[model samples]
Target: MKIVEIGTGYTQIPAKIGAATEIVIENLLNGLNNNGIEHTLIDISYSNQVKNSDKFELSLTHYVNVPNWLNKIKDNGIIHIIRRIWYSIGVGLLLRKLYRNKLQTETYIHFHNQFNFFFAYLIAGRRLRKGKIRTIYTVHSPDWSNSKKIPKKLFFEKIAILKADVIISLTNIIKDRIKESVKINSCKIIVINNGVDLNKYHPIIQGDKQKQIINIGSVCKRKNQLETIVNIKEFLLKENYKFVFAGKIIDHKYFNEIVSYIHSQSLSEHVKYIGEVKPGSELNKLYNKSMLYISHSKQEALSLVVLECMAANTPVVLSENFETFVDFDSKIRNAVKIISNHNLINEINNLCNNVSYHKQYALKQMEVIQEFYTWDNIAKLMIKKLAQFKQTL
Candidate 1:
């Protein structure tokens, strides 16, 4: 069998897309032990210099013409070229022609974002009904499917995705959300937890570890970095623990609120914003130097940062209510400390009181991840399902 993955959105180049694409290809690479199977990745980038593995290939779309192209009007400026007439007419025609050319091949696109999913559906609708090829649509989030303002888009989105043979859900919560919106039942949606390379993120030398705790991810309202900073504020006054807010700042208003709280709490020296750092090197160092990794986000779907910390064998303190810890309830009860208020310092103080014992929970969680989250296992499960699909077809 051959597989094709596509991600066309601009944000598809960011961390989340990077993670999904890495898992897809890495798993396929792991699956290469079977000499009979073939795989290909198609996107806007692989049009040239495609992969050479006879069984695996990368197919790229035509390059975007910058400046003059209407589709690229927002390449830098603040306009939706896709809405413009001239560029849309020209570039849109070229795109339709390109998809028409490629429909001859057997491919299943793992569209990393919603926009591409809808586009793929429209561009390939005729071929899809004729069974010219297969398509696998993974819902990363319910952005387009569940938004109030996107009702028109939602109809096509539902039609396109429900048409798929399979839908991979990163968590059961997301699976339930999809089930509510689409008529497809559980069998059509499979739960495949994302994986981490346990070997790479292993905990490093326990440094003298002055007071440092690291929180990864962009600073945003959804991220709830404010709560973490509040926790740091509380920790600073009670204990000497240092807090490092890594990653770039976003959501300026919320970020400013956090800064104000930090100032009011007099934690300027204790809590440091290290900006963005290299994930492989600098970020790992931050994780290694810290005693615990904390996240205060209210919304999550199997957090990658938490899993990464578990792989590193560092304790994680995530702000989760009763519902958020559905999967790891035991660890949630044992490892997580419920933040009752914005008294983040008090929360961290309460948590740090027994970091070592809580460390066991992270280790146990890591064990669970190693058992179930590895792409090798995920690929095996996916391949088995696909084989069954092929037999049925």
Candidate 2:
């Protein structure tokens, strides 16, 4: 079967920086290519730097150009809505021409963004019937899964769900939440976890690791980096541990709060916030050299970094709030430490003080990554599920 994968249109595919959704799309396409699956990626035009980069293969990619003036507006405001609508219309028109006389059942159109899917449905949904071309929507971030109120985004997400033939959720918890929130049939949703590139992120032999802790994500209130520092204040002050935070500063105010807290507590020497780091080699190196990787994110569908760390044979500690997000089984539970805000310091200490225990957790994490979280394995699972889904159609 042929497949057409659509990106968020806000970021280029084969992302060089910190757009997790775009990165996931890039890896999934690579997985498909490795399996010899016929597919094409439809994404926004790349920047001059990305165009010059030798890292990505653009022969199979179709670039959609949005107006340059739109970039000047603030993100997630009027510009966000306008660009999504523009991209969706472009995608719909392009698909119409591509599939003019082609057999619809032989093709699949997969989408990863709510706004794009919602608007594209308006243009393409009526023309493509249920038994014809299949539309699959993968919910990358179910931000409204736990919300009590119906925000504007949730409304669009609900519409997208109704428009899609099938929905792919990153975790069982998220699948259940989507069912309850949207009142859709559970059979329509498939659970597939995000994947890591094992070839790029693998364990390295080292004599001894220094006392370093690393957290990678956008510096924002949602990621809760400041709270992570607050929880480990004593360690930063008394111990020789260095806390390294890396990501684009999406929220300058929240970053300032982290800086002020670090300064107020005399932690300039112990803590550092290096801005966004490129993915692949740079990220994998950071994961390998650090003694431990930690995240205090308030919400996530499934963190790609968590899997990357595991593939690098690094022990991971997470906030207890992610218990639902990761949806770890008993086997996977032994691979990572999850602690509440109250027990954060104690758990970190337990992992840091015992070298054997740290090694054990790292080994277990690598085992889990090998068994289930590789990109090739995930791509095969998606193909299997799609075959089954076709039988029903």
Candidate 3:
């Protein structure tokens, strides 16, 4: 069977921008290829004209044209919504052409975004009854599971959930949220956690490690980087270790606020800012060299970086607000230090100062990840689920 994976086709399938969803897609396709699946990914290219080709070795990359004018608009809540709807329609047209060709093999159209699901329902819902194609959507973000977005978008998103043949939830939190909000039957929703590329991120031996702590994600309010910065200052002052904040400055005002606080507190010498390191040797090195990895995000669906750090055998610290770690096995959960925001500084210092505890902490976290969260295992689970779906057909 052939699979047509739907996503936002950037200029490249493995985009240099290192968006988490794109990285997950790239790895998921690699996993699928290793399992001997034939698939093609069709995505919206923001360029004015269509530039489609077989670019990626693992899966064919088909770039559908989206108006270049849309790319020029500065990102806002409205523009992002418009972009999603635009890509959804483009995907719908592409599928229509494919259907008209009277394709020979059974096809599975897997959607990564909720907006695409909306257009797919409008375009492919009829074709679904013809039995040539099956549709599935993986809800990768928490926003879809909750009715918290703009009402119009939420309406489309809910309809999309209702229309899909299968729904993949990245976390049980999402699955439960969907069951609660959309009232979808438990049988249709599958809880599959995101997996790490074990080959790229396994533990690495370093000659000399620094007393460095690293946080990787967008510099936005939701990420709560500023709060982490302010709270960690006393720990830095006492330990004289450096903290690296590496990610795009997504929210200018919030970023400026972080910078201002850094200067005002005279912590510039202790803190370093490396803007947006793409996933590669540099990022892996950062994960390897750091003594600890931390995230103070107010909420998350799941964090790929934290898993990458665990794979690198780095001790991790996360705020209590994160729901992802709560889903971890008890032993795995104990390996990570999840503290309330008020106690962050003390917890960080305690972990940093105790060398033996830190070493054991890293080892346990790595062990859990290796045993349970490899991309190969994740792909196998997906294949198993697909096999069951085929039997029903």
Candidate 4:
């Protein structure tokens, strides 16, 4: 069987920076390559980066070069919608050409974004169905999980879910939410957690760690970096604790709010925003050197960073809303501290005070990551599940 992995056109594949979905696509492709699985990756073109580096098998990757102007358009705008539609059409045309006279049942087109899935359906739904070409749509984040009413974008997402032959949910909780909200066969939805590159983010032995706590992701309100700071303000003021924030500044206003609050409160020495750090050695090193990794995200389907931190042997502390781990093994769930507003400070203190426990916790986290959350494991699981799914069709 042939598999076609479709990348969201927003970022180039083998992502050089912090596009989590794009990175996942890259790692999955790598996993496929390692398993000797023959597959094709369709992605946007990157001028500076070689489309097929030594890291990938040359024959397995393809690039769709959109117009320069379209590529430059900022995300979430009307023009961006046009770009996605245009790209989706291009994808359809390419697929048509690739399988011109071949049996579509032998091919699978996998998607990672809602826009790509919905627009591709509009462009080639009839051909896909008549030809019996299986399509898999992975719900990266259920942003509308708590919405009172479906927004226009989410309406399209729901349609995409219904139209897809299979839907991959990052967590069981997300799969349950999709089943509750959308009228689709429960068997078509499967839970496949996001994974980390064990080779890239393995544990690093170190002496006593510094009093540094790290948070990685875009600097935005939804990530709740500012709130995390506020919640730990007493520690920042009275102790030697240092809070370091990294990742692109996605929300200027929110970043300004964090900066202003820090400066006004004379916490500049205790807080730092180091901007985006490139993945691989730099990110893995950052994870290793830190005393703790904390995520205060208000919503997430599954956090790649959290998994990466665990792989790097860093103790993780998560806020209550980061519920992706709810269905995880009890030992795995117990490995990381999940806190609320009431227990946030206390949990942090407890983790910090107990050095032996912290070391054990980090080891447990790494064990879970190696056993179930490696990209290779996730890729193999996906292929096994997809093979079973294809038999039903």
Estimate the TM-score of every prediction: 0.74, 0.92, 0.88, 0.92
Q: What is the lDDT of candidate 4?
A: 0.80
Model 1: per-residue Cα lDDT over 1-393, one tens digit each: 556555342321222322434444444445433334455444332223232333332232233222334333344423442422222233334445545644554555454444555555555556444544666766554343223343564554566567777777766666766677565667777766655655456667665444678787777876677776765565565677778776656577877887888788788888887777654444556666677787776655556666667666666776544245335435334444444445545545644676666566657756766776565665677777766666656
lDDT for position 51 in model 2? 44
Q: What range of 10 consecutive residues in model 3 has the weakest lDDT sum?
A: 144-153
Please give, for residues 1-393, the per-residue lDDT of candidate 3 as tens digits. 777788753334666676888787777788788888888888677655434344566777766677777778776777777777787787887777677656678777888877777776687667654656878888766464334333464676577678887788877766777788788777888777788888778767767568899999988897888877777888888889888988877789998888898899999988899888978666888888888988778767778888899888788898876754236547557778888878888777777788887788888988888888888778888878877877765
lDDT of 2: 0.80
Which lDDT tens digits does candidate 2 get at residues 1-393? 867789888767677677899888888888888777888888775233244124567326766667766655677667777888788777777666666664744677889988778776777665554345778899887575455444665777788777788899988877877877788887778888889988889987766776889999988988889878888879867778999999988788989889999899899989999888899888888888888888888888788888899999789999887875658767567778888878888877877888888888899999998998889888889888988887876
True-structure RMSD, every candidate: 5.5, 2.4, 3.0, 2.4
Summing lDDT over every window of 10 consecutive residues in candidate 2, give the lowest-scoring window. 46-55
Enumerate clash totals for all models, in the order shown: 8, 0, 0, 0
- TM-score for candidate 1, residues paired by index: 0.74
lDDT of 4 by residue, 62-142 (tens): 677677777555665677677777777777777666655648346778898887777767776766675647888998865
Candidate 2, TM-score vs. the true structure? 0.92
Model 4 poorest 10 in a row by lDDT: 46-55
Stronger candidate by lDDT (2 vs 3) = 2
In model 1, pairs of residues that clash are: 46-60, 47-60, 211-242, 230-344, 231-344, 231-345, 234-345, 235-345
